[model samples]
Target: MSGSREWLCYTDGSAKPGTGAPGGWGFVVKPPSGSAGPAREGYGKATGTLAKIMEYRAVAEALEVLPERAQAVVFSDNQSLVESLEKKLESWRASGFRNVDPLVVESVRLIDRAMNDKELVVRFQWVRSHNGNPGNERADQLAAQGAREAKADLAVTTKRR
Candidate 1:
């Protein structure tokens, strides 16, 4: 693919109804060719983790799966995540990741990974959640499924013991 082409990616993260619950994140990638690609989702032990972290994880996971040297615009429903990536990333780096209020240091690692990828040109776009956006809705569903799967996996493992 030409480096000039841009891909579109929609990403979302979901946690269960309570704090310290398991959560999941997912992304849907649309290549420049205008064909939708496979969606990616993951489950993790999200106990004590913030939803923002999961949101950032979704973006990072999407970037990781894209082809090297791909240019893409990633759409996210999390305003904080979008703002951090678009506005706060440089300041956070200059501060050496310190003394920042309303900043998530946990997401910095993944954000840094995405930013440092010389092969990828990634931009973030914020979309309203559950606002009848097809991509965002699909991403949300995938994330929920991932969370459920994670819980189920934990249950199975416990039974095995």
Candidate 2:
């Protein structure tokens, strides 16, 4: 393991539409080699709200924001999400994600894009949430904040539009 580095990435999403708006997604990346870059954070909003979609979006956003040449291993609390991305993607897509929620498709697209990027080698794993993993906790908080911001921005944007 000497001179080898791995990146630990965590992502989360929130869908609280009770405020009369859709929710958002968020993600945070921590480098195992050492702290690096500006530390990334991102958010995206959608018409309806679902934690799965938001979670998928957050991971996608993180992948996009990560340095192109960096090698990474993403840790998520969602077992289904990880398994789908790491293994079941092709079958799911072929089956039209049958019996699967639309969010699963959206998430797969994001993962595919990330993997197809010219310079990314990503492996995903499942981590237990709220167990006090600092990086995961940070990512979770950032995700919640992103959701709130997205809802607020959506309201503002909708009003203006």
* Model 1 global lDDT (CA atoms, 0 to 1): 0.73
**Candidate 2 positional error at 102, Å:** 2.6
Model 1, span 24-101: residue lDDT tens: 778887778645565444434344445676777788777777777778888999987888788877787788778444
Q: What is the lDDT of residue 29 in candidate 1?
A: 77
TM-score (all chains, Cα) for each model: 0.78, 0.77
lDDT of 2 at 77: 80
Residue 60 CA displacement from its true place in model 1, Å: 1.0
TM-score of 1: 0.78
The sequence of per-residue lDDT tens digits that candidate 2 reaches over residues 1-161 is 22247666788777775654466676777665655555566566664677788788778878886777677888788787888778876676577667456655666766766766746778888889999987678778877776777777778877997
Name the top TM-score candidate: 1
- For candidate 2, the TM-score is 0.77
